[model samples]
Target chain A: MQEELFAPGHRGCAGCGAAIAARLILKGSGKDVIIVSPTGCLEVISSPYPESAWKVPWIHSLFENAAAVASGVEVALKSLGRKDEAKVIVIGGDGATIDIGIGALSGMLERGHDITYICYDNEAYMNTGIQRSSSTPYGASTTTSPAGKVSFGENRPKKNLPAIAAAHGIPYVATASIAYPKDVIKKVKKAISIEGPKYLQIHAPCCTGWGFDGSKTIEIGRLAVETALFPIYESTEGKVTSVKKVKRKPVEEYLKAQRRFSHLFKIEGGEEELKKIQDIADSNAKQFGLDQ
Target chain B: MEIMEGSRAVAEAVKACRPNVIAAYPITPQTHIVEEIARMVADGELASEYVRVDSEHSAMSVCVGASATGARTYTATTSQGMALMHEVLFNAAGLRLPIVMTAANRSLSAPINIWNDQQDTVSERDSGWIQLYAEDTQEASDMIIQAYKIAEDHDILLPVMVGMDGFILTHVHEPVELCPQEKVDDFLPSYDPAYYLTPKNPLSFGTIVYPSTYTEFRYMIHEAMKRAERKIIDVASDFRDKFGRHYGGLIDTYEAEDAEVLIMAMGSVIGTAKDAVDELRSDGKKVGIVKVRCYRPFPAEAISEAVKNAKAIAVLDKNISLGYEGALYTDVKSALYNENGPLALGFILGLGGRDITKNTIKSIAEKAQKAIKSGRVEKDSEFVDVGVL
Candidate 1:
């Protein structure tokens, strides 16, 4: 077996999808990489002064500057005549990617830095106790966007970060899920192999925040892909090159497994809300050709 | 000596330091300095990687990353740009990256003025970076090289901010003797960090410190700043030995001994104050000047010793603390707290591009003399040279 760069003593919760993504990412990139993490769950859990689970070089600076930090590391290596030493990678959460850090991320992609930025999308601000983030799925209830008499949980659709990343005309962009560990590793390898900036958004479910059974993390992640609520695909130079085709599962299969969406089944006009969420899944399927 | 723009002189000094990476975002008054460095990088005169960042926050973040990776790094900004970089500044210092930045001092906004003032960097006094002020183009250029030596010292390993007044020093043209590259290379060697981000060593940086150890880390930074005071003086002495130029270590004095009155100030205002002191001495008024070169690691001991025998001391501040007195005035009072020291008074003037003339300093000195004769101060801190609308 390969040397485990992500050691076993981290403080991540049981069945944490982000922890699985972190282990698999290091496995794919090997030990010849420097990880730049922003302020998020993975950084806080993996590193807590005088102790770290990372057996490789890792740095956690702030919430909104991981891409900028990675750019500096990549250029510093080239300037020091050690460009072949290691690949630079950034592992940030969704709040650090689609929300506060989007400006720096866009700047990095525009500059064409030789770095791979992977954002583990846990949907909400899990580190800050399930606050609503731009990446929160539609009709899902979080602490900040609690469903009630006047509100329908998160009223807006998720931010299309992968498309925004590809719009920068980057070399590669892909989406993966922690349930498919092999695919996650494969995409990480391909991203590092590319010469310019590449972005990958991995759907990593949160068991605690999503109100699901700890053992059901991978099961729910697979449901997200199979139901077409979250499409898994690859785009190269702004064109869709490959996608994970699925025999379409009902959206209810994915929603019923998590308590965040359980309110919809009990609410007064929740069937109409359920139909709206189904339409969102249908839109994703049509756009990515996920139901081949 | 060759006549060069202050910005060009600074760029020349940075080239001599041989930094591995330079990241900067342009703002008013600071644009000329970075532009010259960028041009040199383009012309093949300097072989450093110049990353043009999108904002000042990223500019500092880029420096933090590069410096953590065992590379010498540099950046420059001012005023609102420095305000934008407040969070990253603390992070860089906490990580002990030893990055050097040029803060071309400019006034803060609300009225939105892009003119010369010391409020920008002064606002960041507690961010754990050594703060140095420059009185002229030559001193500003020379301090950049010295800043790197002081910051990269293993005993120190703290970031440094070399502050020069915007438009006053940044835009002025002066005859500056540019140090030869070989001499600078000898005085300041290549950066050899004890710890850095490298896959070969596999170390982590900027870890989250819990309550049990966070205070210890902060205390260590405080101790490092205390040690940096001595390093700053030693580096300046060595620089003077090699280059035949010396600005005093923490505080530079002019005719300060055996004087009845003393004036204290920093940055370009010191030049005007020096002329004012010369006039006062020739008139047999028994006055002198104390120029504060290093503002942080506040030279309280040196300041108290310098003004010990004097009856009254006047402090001129280009920046104010809004509701309170001038920041320097407050610090000067604190320095003189335990001693039977001079009756120190503060005068706020020359803010937001307002000129500080010789006459202004002479009048401030006259006010100090009056307080000495009265044996007490009428007003503690007063704003000088405010014309009624």
Candidate 2:
């Protein structure tokens, strides 16, 4: 309807999950939105000065202040009597959302600003050449947290951002994936319609960073949700209202697909770590009631 | 003129300036300023969006957001709070958002002291902000209105930080003549930026700049700072014309003319220094004080002119550059570099809220007198050992 708010012809890698997710996010937001993006892959690949891929109004200031900037834009509009008309939206990567930008993000939510924050969580710091972020899943290999002789890659499980954001008592919080493009769009749209601070974290598989075939990005994202590695769910007013039901496949169906987790399957005694990851998935399933 | 707390005076001035948005986090000395503004907002006296952010970084970030959208935004903080705001400070300036902030100057920590010092604002000297320091409570109140005018000037759309000594200027009650809102309205018009965030006319801000273009944008900020020096002076002149009060544009002087020894300092210490200088002048020892009001632009030419004739110059600094000397002493010394000026001495005093009595300042003046007589730079960096707590 709005002639593609985020047009093609940019530096996003072919088969980029973030690129697809960003495009759909704009569609969900329609045209009446002021977007704030932090320093990340989307910021680098889309906006390069005189030439920009973003057709809508957008700003990228620092690594961790997009939420703060969006909050400012929200109030500025309120001050000018335009708050009800235009919505404030912030899009950032997991590093900007879960790591460095967490403080400002928490502030934006706790203050109950009317902003829809969408974190394109590609698991690691992909913009800076495949470094590990808190959102990186357990047993996944990243440049910073590589699978060494004694190490089985990233030692910690991915940070549960949806749960964390839900704890803020904001109106809405959801987790979606690029595999379900319509689901992603629906969740973002629902978030935008909410009255106060809302968070939507999309699981975007990084083709280049995650050592996967470029074509398998979407397929792998679907497997992540299917295997309960990234359980898709929605929460309202801090309560888990719904969760994406799955047949509950083993974690290997997800981990074996990506070379980042190959060490856990190949190395001797790696089954112990694999079992640990399975336990993590099982725990997430129990927390969000994904198995039911 | 009524006896009002310095924080209340600043709050009244901000109210008179009529900011559309005020967002800040609480910190020592600076808390009361925001508290008063909050009370005003609650009472419906100040019709503004007062956002209570979680931290100083968010406070500044919120201001940047509000300012970018063409709203008159204001915030206040001190010390570590200012340090927390250091990153967003650059974002506001780099985006060319004209937000006004009052940093009630307080010391930084390790030993965790939270009293008066210029260390916080001084550390952010290179943050691309127009840093203005105030000498007293009245100047602190008056400068906030003047800061809004200077910052929002289209030609000089840069953020301005008005710094006042922590506790000394903020907590102290002083007689202040609050500018009427009618006059303040005439002085500072509503904020209407050349560009803003609107769906109808969208423009990108804070985009990452490549090396090919980054330097030029930074060069523009530098150029804006240079323009701000003149803008600050003109706005101060305009404010003085309207209100019958004068804040010497870049740097304020107290008997610096025809003096043999000149002492340079900033913040509330200037009052004590002035008293010491007058006592020395009456006793027939030539000494005067140069109150540094605009710190960021450094007011290089103005500072050189003020201290050019003095035979001996001593700088009283509450901040140390750690192994290097006082930050202001370094700047003042650099200002006189091209003029073959007198060897200026750096005196570090009153750090972490040490009381700088008239005796301490007189002793500093006496040292300057001694430097003038001996025609030698005796102490390169003097700590002025004021016996510990």
Candidate 3:
């Protein structure tokens, strides 16, 4: 592995989840990799050229076409007969991966191309100033999902993307978090080694959008996995292979650390909201077999 | 060595140039080009990755990915297909990938005319691509070969558009001198993108730009385009030196000397206009023509010089702006304005897939020549053929 593919002088804000995810991904994929990034925070801050944090070859196309661009890289390598020599990886925000770029990713996967798609889900569209995204969690407060008198933040649950990618029957699909660098890097390495299309969803919490301590980026992400709000698991061709069933903690341990959910605590009858959050976490735990 | 349609000629040229990746969808007029290439690939005549994308948008997207990964890529499309791939087109240009595509010029919606016209390519003029309009099959075949070399030039890394008229040039069979594989190989070097997505050089692409840095990035793109103007000419000159063919960059002139009036046109209309000029010359009428090759770069200087000595100039456009004059008319008018030159006239002709006959050109020349001799402006700028309608 190259010592520092994504060098240290990046301008990512404190506790920036996407930045951490990028570092782990680079470390996991090692030195021989091409990265296709969609328009997002990590892309904006890391590359303000003529000074870039990346030490390797990188390309930034558009907001909704990272997967397609990565596919181009794959085909180019195939033409050069270098598919085995270099791995092609596409990294984008959840908004770009699950929403705008979904069709391209689906087509690429259906075509059974040699590529890996890594989506760093920060929940909302943070780069555009905390706007609501399809991946924004239920009861999350964004600019568009304000917690007004009658509103309880977001009304929709986070879109289940891994399940969707798994439905494609791709060779590998997994979910990881920036909190666990080893876990995220391991999954990335596994996906890269796979022959066919692979997908990875990395949970990276945003400090500015989630109203959490910027320094708590890693700790909060760990709590997300530990509290069972976010599960760490991998699947191959619609079949579950492995899952990280950690020692579970109370859901409040995860919620109390973030300011975006602080309103739920401030309101009267806060116990009901807390119960709903717990119910959601319990369902995820039972579904993914995260609870022993 | 055999005669072929413009589409087949382009396909043959593409085969000779040897693209590593070909991704495209079937669209009218443009379909035959991709179909022929697919057949060649299937027959093992061309060694490439032929991707049959679900849509035009995907076709371009796949091409972008393939090209970025270090493959020589190609595709072709018509009106609606070009419009559908609009989003990816800008990306290809902005990323500065040397992608070569053939756009069979056709009319836009809502009537949905898929005949010969320039509306499709003109709509994408500002897409930051090297736009070239071919006068015939030979030019179409030849321009593509030059396009690859010009686009891949380190100083001018931009996508190139080689446009032929739908149904007219794309469908009609004509005798085009096909360049042999060795000649083409010698002419066009393998595509080597300046910036590639390679593992040895791990880098993050597509960063979000703030207002403070946005202007500078756009300025760099602009500067690259300005640099392309010189590089295109140099590439064309190099092609002429090596292949014994010349595009002369920006614009190609025909019989402009000692002429009272000049007809400015683009695409296949240049062929018709040239024939009309020769016939009129035999009839003792002083008429010549100037064909616009590079529309995006506008070629303001070339057009100005070609029409400077003429008493009158008429600009022909196959696209109408609706409630206003044609797109080319505005550009040509601005190029000739207050230049101490002849009066420039705007003629909205052959739009909506209307055919531009030699008689139409002869009549336009007669009327324009009379206006120039009289030293008086015509009653109208737009000269529509009501007689034909």
Candidate 4:
């Protein structure tokens, strides 16, 4: 077995999907990688001074600027005449990637830097007490977008972060989930091989933030893909190259799996709200040919 | 030596420093320096990675990354661009990376004016970065070289902000001696960072520090700044041995050695103040100039030593502390806490690009004369250039 670049002892919550994705990412990256993380659950949990779960060269600065920092590391390596031997990877949560940090990410991609940018999309700012982020899917209840008497949770669709990166005409862009570890590893390896900017958005199901059974983390992630709620796909130069086909289960199956969405089942007009979620899944299936 | 724009001279000096990476984002009055650097990179005069980042925030972030990897890095921005970089500025210093920046000091907005002022860099006084102000275009060019040396000193591994007056110094053409690459090479060796981001070495940078260890890390930066006072002077002495000109150590003095009334200021206005002091001296007045070159690491001891004998000290500040007095006026007063010294008056002037004539300095000297005769001043601080209501 390959050595764990992300060591075993970490403060990550039990069955944290981000921790699993981080492990899989480190495994694919192997030893010749420098990781830059923005402020998030993974950063706080892995780094607490006296110990660090990162066995690789890693840095976590602010909530944003991971992509820009990665660009610096890449450019510095290239300048030092060692660009080929190492790879720069920026890992940040959805809030940092899709929202606050998108400008820096866009700059890095458009400048055509040779780096891999990873966004572990956990929907909300899990490290900051579950505040809603732009990546929060419509109808999901977060602390900030709590399902009060007259309100549904986040009132917007999840920001299409992968598509945003692909539109930069980068060399590679892919979406994966922790449920498919092998697939995640394969896509990451592919991204590292490419010469220019590559982006990966992983569906990281946070058990603590999403109020799910810790042991059912992988099961919840699989249901998300099966329902077409989190379509897994690869795009090259703005063109969708391939997608993981789904059997197209109702979104209710995915929603029923997490307590963050328990309100839609327990409240009045709950069925109607559940139907709206199904419409979103149906849209993703039709748009990405995920049902084919 | 050739006549060059202040920005071009700085660009040539940066090339001499041989930075491995430069992140460029244009802000007015700072655009010329970055443009020249870009041209140098394209024409093969400088072999460096010129990263064209989108905003000042990304510019600083890239520098933070490049510096962490032990690469000598450079960037230039002004006013609003500097404000955009506020968040990363702390990160850069707290990480103890020696990234050097040229902040073409310009006034901040509200009515949105783009002209020379010290307020932008002064507002970032507590960001833990060393702040240096230049008195002229030539000093602006020379200080960029000094900044890299002082910042990267292992004893003082902190980011340095080199401030030159917007349009006044940055846009003005002056004869500046562009130090040869060989001399700069001898002065600045290849940067060898004790800590860096490398896959082979495998270490973490900017990791989360609990409250238990955070204060100690911050204390390290404070200690570095305390140590920088000596390092800044040492680098200047070393720089002077190689290059024939000396841009004073910390605070540059002009005839303050034998004067009763001392006038003080930073940035290009000090150049004008010097000219005014010379004119006042010819008229049999004991007025002199104390050009503030290094603003942060506030140089309190240097200020005390320079103004000890002066009967009264007048500080012409381009930046006001709003409800309080001028920023430097406050620092100078605090430095005199345990010593008997001059009755210093703070005069706020030339804000938002209003011109600072030699006569403005004379008017300030007159104010000091009145305060010196009475051994008291009418007010703590007052504006000299804002039109009367």
Candidate 5:
């Protein structure tokens, strides 16, 4: 109810997790924040020339330069003696954050600009119809990484962007899920309050791209956290300070809920692939102490 | 007047403009300018946020963001750096950011050349930014101040690139009368944009344009470019009135009115062409020089009017469009398509730092005279001073 900064009537699909994240993010940051978004699903759906869904100041430049753009906005405010007037934030997707925009993101983090960069991680490039991105999970079938007779699905593991972000020696880095609205809002508020660059990656599931019921978006996100496949945690200055621990559920429970992983139940040699995926989750749990 | 390197003069001029933010990635010949700016910022001579970006793409992107945020922004890069910024250049212009940049004109590379040529900026002619070429260090310094005035005009809210020959002008020492801070503050007032990214209004910028209205947006940009032609001229007139120095409006001419043949060029080569014209006149050759200062909004009418009485024209281009003739030659011919114009010939020279001496200008004049005597061109385009491999 916090002023509904991300207004309704946007073109986001029903039960869109990124749409929910955008609203929750603005709710926490309030009106005195400028948002910079690259070319992604949220940018396309929210801003259509003469119409806009955002009540806060926002800008969308190119597909891979949101961090750099936000850097400019932050520095401009500082230069104009209005640094305290607004907090600059960049809301980009996994593809824009982990792949094409990594250089600019690294630059922004390295330069220590007073901004918070948030990546709504829906795994694949959902804006371009589910092409495989660097953040796409292993064994998850996508448009570009379709499960085939000779291939299982995505061949590589999801890139550990939080760790990469923390490597910059930034003040804060956090990972959250869209299911935990309060947690997402809290982390955003906390990140913005810190001085230098802070990165927050939220696991926002895509019902349309992940081949699941639109109504099950939040449920699927919760499953991802519960199964320990997407560890929810916060690191302050390279040290893990807080984590969302859960009694671990089998990775199959999470994989079985989405059609992207439905192929694993039917295909030959898929059980072994499923075991490999469980090993990945186990490793993540061990790394972040996510298992209760 | 103070004697200083072209790069330092440009930095001094930029300091006087009082930009709110500056972002740039250093490339050869442009490095000295940004480095000088950084020195001034460290010395407290200028109070601007200098963001040292990793690449030229980010540099231009930073300018777009700052300019959209209602801050006057500046940046500079050249050659491969400019090529790397190709897409962002189009984005900045389309967004109507009115960010001013100095393009230390250098040749694009396959052989990896880092020398003076107009090819770098010439390739970006269609990117919707107003392009102005400078003939010397003084003009290059003066144009930076004029560029901001022209670009930040609400009626002509388009980005501008002030092109100076890389190394040739950027590295040379010359006596430049740097404008006083007070005078510049009067000539170019602080940038106050009508639309900007502000929390008070909370508006969105650079939104997605659908096919339903994309063409209309493009057409509006085109219309704005057309309007900027007059704005460029008027700003130049105002600059001359205030500063007591004049670099002609669209095309500056030296004795072109009654000449039998006209020599046309841009950038620092104009200085050499002027000396060549003086010599040609003393020898009764009846030749004059026409300097195309503003390349974009391509000053066709002014060019045609300048060379209307000439029997032939020789256009010296430091940039070639490959497969065809020089880019300026193509534009000049198209400009004269409907008029009883001169028999124009194209001469590509001085590319990749090849020196364009006074002798080169004299020989080009001889070619124009030959075309006049024959009442036709021997060849539409030819490379000047090519030696055997």
Candidate 6:
């Protein structure tokens, strides 16, 4: 009805998946919201001081404590008797959500605060240069986890943040992607309307860190969803009730677009690595009943 | 109106402060502070939001949010609870919100003992907060009032921590003159946060910053802390003028002039040191005491001057720096290095619930005096009274 809350002039790179994810989230949340963002690319680029691209009330706190900070905002508002005045939202990169900030996030979730936490999963720590994060998919090459002669790129499976959120038994928890713009917005809107802690992890491809064509951000996101690499679903109180499933496409369709996985195709690792990624997706699909 | 325990005095002061929100979890010695506040809120003695936060981290978080929304806020925690809040503590300071907190000083965990000590407050020294150490219940009550003033001051908008040594002062009841709400209101104006979550003016705080200017934002916090140094002195002076009790800036000295031996301490242990000084004085020992009221904005100038004339200085630290020396020992040694005055003795005492008895204090003073005379500083600081199995 009104112009989307995520205005233009944000310094996110051209076609950056996380930027697009942020914009999609803003569109879903609308303008009457206070956003608490953790220190990451979105915060750094959108708010460079003197001027900020965010048209909404936003706060950028430290990296490992955005959820805790958001809880503070919630407490402060509730104390001031302003809880219904505006919705409180938290946005951060994968590192902030999955690694360093996990404890803070757990505390917020355990408290059952009324807020929406959005994780723009760009795979690696793109803001501080492309270091490998726990969420970086197995066999993906990052600056910290280089693909060399006797080793696969990153050796660990991606952290299951959705499952972790579900374990908290929060009111609402979902996983979306930047590729499905309308769907991401729809899920985010649903999350905001929920009473207590709501979490949404959106799959956002990193163009710079992953070495991809900046113009193909949406296309990569779409491929990620179609190939079952990133599924869209929602869980309430640890019970999965709804999912957005699609016809499975080859993993190559998702991997070929990014150079971080380029080694898997070029070296002797592609098939094995692809199998590992497919296994992860397959397990997720089965757990959430995404394949109908 | 009547004599109250230090914890109860702090609790009453917070109640009268009229905080819109009070969120804190209870720990030993610190439990009574929050329990009283909660009871007051529940009985309608105070109209406030009292949150039984799961942890100290959540308690601080709730206060941060409430403060950002233009509500005056307060919380209390000690020892492990304080350590758990290390992350949020930095956030509150960086945001420049005037949320007041009371920390009942106690040692940290790992042979966890819930008793009186300064380890808890001392460990958080570098978190960019205005730290004040109180000697007695009256000072504790008065400091809470002034802490709000100093923290909410426009030039020094930062979180302020009021420290009372756990069981020693927190649970110890004493006479404290309660400042009427009218006086408190005059001393501390209604909190008008510079930045807040208001609809009339839509603004973003804590916005992300690029390397091009991120350093400057952090430096701004440092600048505000430095500004707090001068503001603290002015506020304390004004408070003394109004209340007739002088806290004497960041550093408060007691009978230091013309004394050859200077015993320096902080928190309620200064009370023990003062009694020790009295005993030594009656025996005609040239000894005096200096209490560090403000721990951060470290009071370097005031400390140097306090110990300038003393030939022997013994600094008592309630916290160990682990593998190094005590926290205050390092800071005091560094502060006195340029003056080349006082053969300094570092004594780590009352760590993890060990009581600092008058006899213990006298022994320390005697040892320190002998060390000064012999010119042999006790480089290996003692972790006083820690037992072995």
Best by DockQ: 4
The docking category that best describes candidate 6 is acceptable
**Model 3 Cα lDDT, one tens digit per residue, B1-389:** 57788889999999999999998789898989999999999999999988777678878888888887778999999899999889789888877788999999888888877677788888888888889899888888888898898888887788999998998989888887888889788778787667666676554555556788878877777777778777777877887887778856888778888888989888999988988989999999889988888887677887888888899888898887778877888888888777887877778888767878999999889778778778877654674784653
The reply for model 4, stretches above 4 Å from the true place, is none
- The parts of candidate 2 lying over 4 Å away from their true place are A283-292, B386-389
lDDT of 5 at A180: 96
Which ten contiguous residues of candidate 5 chain B have the minimum total lDDT? B367-376
Superposed by TM-score, candidate 4 places the C-alpha of residue B149 at a distance from the truth, in angstroms, of 1.3
The per-model DockQ list reads 0.83, 0.76, 0.51, 0.86, 0.83, 0.44
lDDT of 6 at B136: 84
Candidate 6 residue B163 C-alpha distance from true site, Å: 1.7
Query: How high is each candidate's TM-score?
Result: 0.99, 0.97, 0.92, 0.99, 0.99, 0.89
Write the residue-wise lDDT of candidate 5 on A234-290 in tens digits.
998899999999999999999999989998999999999999999999999999888
In terms of lDDT, the poorest run of 10 residues in model 1 chain B is B272-281
Overall lDDT per candidate, in order of appearance? 0.93, 0.89, 0.85, 0.90, 0.94, 0.84
Model 2 per-residue lDDT at B286: 82
Model 4 over residues A66-142: C-alpha lDDT tens digits?
99998899999999887876789988899999989999999999999999999998999999999999999989999
For residues B73-176, write the lDDT of model 6, one tens digit per residue: 89999999999889788888988889899999888887878877788888899898889999888888888888988898888889999998888889987888
**B-chain TM-scores per prediction:** 0.99, 0.98, 0.96, 0.98, 0.99, 0.96
Chain A alone, TM-score for each of the models?
0.99, 0.97, 0.97, 0.98, 0.99, 0.96
Query: Candidate 1's residue-wise lDDT over B66-179, tens digit each?
Result: 888888999999999999999999999999889999999999998899999899999999999999999999999999999999999999999999999999999999999999
| Candidate 3 chain B weakest ten by summed lDDT | B200-209
Greater TM-score among 3 and 6 belongs to: 3
Identify the runs in model 6 with alpha carbons over 4 angstroms from their true place: A1-4, A143-157, A167-169, A236-241, A266-273, A279-292, B1-4, B26-29, B52-62, B109-113, B175-177, B208-219, B237-246, B304-311, B320-344, B367-389
Angstrom error at residue B148, model 3: 1.1
